[model samples]
Target chain A: MKSLIDFGAVKIYIDCSVKLAERNINHLYPSYVLEDNTVPPDYFVSLKYGGGIRRFVRKQVLFEQDSKSHFKPVPENHAYASFEWGLNYVVSNYAQEFLTIHSGVVANNDKAVIFPAPPGSGKSTLTTYLMGLPGWRLLSDEMALMLPETSYIQPLIKPVCLKNNSIDIAKKWFPDGKFSSIASATAKGDVAHLSPPASSWQQRDRVAKAKAIIFPKYTPNKKMEIYKLDKNQGFMQLAENVINLSLQGERGFNTLTHLIENTEQFEILYSDVNEVKDFIEQDLL
Target chain B: MSKHKISSQQLFDLLADSQNALDLSDSDWVDVIRIFRSESVLARFACQLEESGVITQLPSYATKHLANAKLVAQRQVSSVRFECAEILHIAKNTCEKLYLLKGAAYCLASLPVSKGRTFSDIDLLVTKDVLAQTETSLKLHGWLSEPLSKYDEAYYREWAHEVPPMKHSGRGTVIDLHHNLYLPVSGRAPKVELFLEGAIETDGFHILRPAAMTLHAIIHLMLNDDLKHAFRDLNDLHLMMTEFSKQAFWEDLLDLAHKSGFENELFLACRYCRHFFKTSISTEYLTKLANMQNMNQSEIKLLDRFYALALSPKHYLVKRASANFAELVIITRAHLKKMPIKILLYHTAYKVYRSAVESLLGKAFFEKSNS
Candidate 1:
């Protein structure tokens, strides 16, 4: 089946076996598919989270298919609203131009901030908080797809995951903000996704040239601190943050070199989101 | 010119059924070899299949060659854990605690089969003050110390980041216990405590999480400067990316690399993964990070070429003489740096002698067969 979603100037066709349901949103066209086997009936869902969120799973299969394939279907009405959220991932990622980055992306009019952090660093929480700012757009909470040739970011514009206290913090910060179903006690701590801002969905394919690379750390009760990194050191730091520099080989290396040469780099350590926001807006902006 | 009609799907199927189909007269080993381009990738695939319980189905001859590959992969996997376990056991026995690095911790925590990556030696990190004790404990376990020339041993003990290699009697495993991640000579190395503080416990083993392991792999690849058979090393990175993606373990991986002082390696790994495995990482993040890393246009092109050549499964079977030459040069450089000049010269001479002997024996055998 074919389903078309308008992502700003680009209309993407999500062709899969799944049934599509169109919402008022510009980019999201959620869909789900059920599997039919001779033995018994089984259900699988494919979701398009925006860029490339397509994935298939059998409800009963786990760990058995690890060696054979990467896709695993979780219980529906869980994690994602429907399988369409996951299907979006597959279609978007299949495109050759976009390289999927494993990080949180938040952007304002002038620049986007990409936070590359290990677990427990509170990057997702920080990303959620940052997108709550008045003018900034939430590019993606999970991945940041950047074009290698142009260094331009295509908007994933998915839901932002906020964990534990961050969920409450987000609710308090933006009472009007929407959220999906809460998924508690996950591997990454208790998780809930903040709804994408209406404006972000409106300009889903808008590409942003990153202006700053921030390595964020959530230190409990620590005063907010931002340290500027030198070009050489920053280059190394950014290189380490990349997902597949070696696979891209020469193209990856050159792209990374160019990215480092052009952007400002810093390490941000903070406990207070409000304080971090002020620093980002007043000093960096 | 006729276009080649080999299908990847067909090759994959043939590889899957090579053992049962071995009786077919048309099923030649050359065709099997041609389907797989890189020995390393074939080796990795064979090892993975073997680990997954399909080894018995492979042709016996193919299995024998793959056994060496499996051994290498296993050794790499085991070296990490074995060294970490040995060190930890020693430290616990002696009331001194130590921290495990990268692969050692990862294998211990999650993947039992990861012990397949061939490691020449086990690597351990201990406090500088406890180096003597660690060495003594290792020796007590029947590990024979390789005689490093006096000056080199002194440098290793006093000024270098790690100790000389030691071999175990029972398993013939080698160990390279270290006090630091990078050479102290680098002037700006992160403190060992950074890794120690982040060590996680899983399945009764304390190991580096995904992040630390990714950083460790990157640091090892970047600092060695020995790209000999580096195509294999690239394969290892690809394997890690593919396996890790199954768990959706990207964020943790990136974070750990950043924390461990190898952020560049993480980006490079992600970029390489995208280029080779068709992994689902974001391009925006890759380019943004690449730009942040200062990878320019020309460097990007080179990386892509290297990735395409190194990672393609098609390259594993059809041998390229130039790649072999490049690998030889790299190996020679790495060996020469580590060995004494006289020893290096002697080894070179011995290699030549061995090659001459093999060539003479082959010629005689061929003549006999013809007669």
Candidate 2:
């Protein structure tokens, strides 16, 4: 059987016969996916049992694009996790309509705050906390899609990917939030996903005006500190962080300049989530 | 080289005639989309269908992908323009004349080949006298040459026609500056000065005139060893012919080729384009070229068979069994024409050693992706 998830900017069709893939789709992506299965998918993804009965004792499953095998086979239990990564691979390569960034985005009052950072920088951890604040919505936890002509960020509305210790932190912060089973010792360390709130999924199509860019770093014992960043420095970081800036070319340059000119830029070092949230609300807003 | 179930021939036929869309099933559209993406011609396919007023007939899903493809193609068009302007600004102080070449020329001149075309490097042609000065000016403007070994540098400087490629430090775009079309060591290398006699100036930049432009495209296709871009090169030739055929382009092209001593390459380009795309040329002109050729009918027939297989789409899905063998033969011929036997052996040895070293150092040393 197949399921379809239309994440506003792109539609993905997930096809799988494995039990683990089915369960994860129902639990982690329920709010964003449509009940109707008729939507024509931009990409067809599949996960099926493989490796024969000898290794099938462990029940390995392979990820496929258009029914052709791709990537190495993983344990069957990780099939659902592999599906999301596969979808990202397709969109990051094919989606030329927007300049995608490796960032997390959360919005308040229809204004978005983009957190562009590296992998171990507590980006997803910050986004998870912001989703709990009043009048706040999660736009995206991994990919920030910025329209090149409009300077607006569209909501991707996928579940947050929490890794290692951050997975436990996410669960403790949002007790009621749903999460998928954790896969241990993977490439990015032990990984799990926290389902986004229903309200964020409800307004997934509402594009947000970009308000501030905060490059955050999690320092263990340091007090909360925030410093204003020069617009040119911000522009350079944004250019380096973008996944598809080359495809956007000159238009991307013009759009990014306009974005930096109008938005507040800052680099913050902190270990406490509450202090960061307070600063965003009382100072930056 | 992942294999696909269906061949690219069907997609090629559909692109050749958009009316054939009526016969494609939904599954066929999937295969066609893959082929177009692999060949980097999806935008061209979409634009052709839209121009024919048949885009409305395409399935909604197919049109969605085409719309995205068009957006990318549009961006590439603008990118080429911006790069050309920047190059002109840098070359203003040092070079006397700069001529745009190949895809950059087609786009800047607003020719037919610019439609839905995507390219990476910008190619420029200048006189041999200004070559050193041009390199110095470019370096002053932050265009740094790639680090090349002693042998490779000598190969480019002493034997190759073009100077070593330089890339802008800030923009990260490559520029290839050429003083001649063929290798200095090649037997078929033409008189480099004749190409400059008739040049067209547009927007304060010079381009090869229509006749020379088409001849250069032919020479590039026939003399080069790389067959990966064979399909795209053939399509470029087809587009160029369709646009230039309006004027006395053929006579001018033949005359230019005769003077440059590149008539054989021009003939091969025309024959292949005609056979593959049904490129329209007057039968009288075809007879004239055929009679002028010193090679007998059997030789031409054999060459046609070789190119027919080699020039067709070489994607994993559409590649014929004989395609690799055909490419090997053509490549050997190209090498033979490029250098004498003694020099060729040394050249091949140096290339192999450099390639092995680059691979061992991992791919980061050599920049690969053109786009």
Q: Report DockQ per prediction, comma-separated.
A: 0.01, 0.15
| Top model number, lDDT | 2
Stretches of candidate 1 exceeding 4 Å from the true structure = A1-285, B1-44, B50-88, B94-96, B102-106, B110-115, B150-155, B169-171, B202-205, B246-249, B256-261, B303-319, B324-371
**What is the Å distance of residue B84 in model 1 from its true position?**
6.7
Per-residue alpha-carbon lDDT of model 1 for A97-212, expressed as tens digits?
A: 34546678788894887887776787878788777778988877766666775556777655566777878888887787766555445444555666666777766767788777
TM-score (all chains, Cα) for each model: 0.41, 0.74
Model 2 steric clash pairs: none
True contacts kept of each: 0.00, 0.11
lDDT scores for all predictions? Answer: 0.56, 0.80
| Per-residue alpha-carbon lDDT of candidate 2 for residues A185-272, written as tens digits (9 for 90 to 100) | 6777788988888778887889998899999999998899998988888999887788877777777777788788879989999999
Error of 1 at B363 (Å): 22
What does the lDDT read for residue B82 in candidate 2?
A: 89
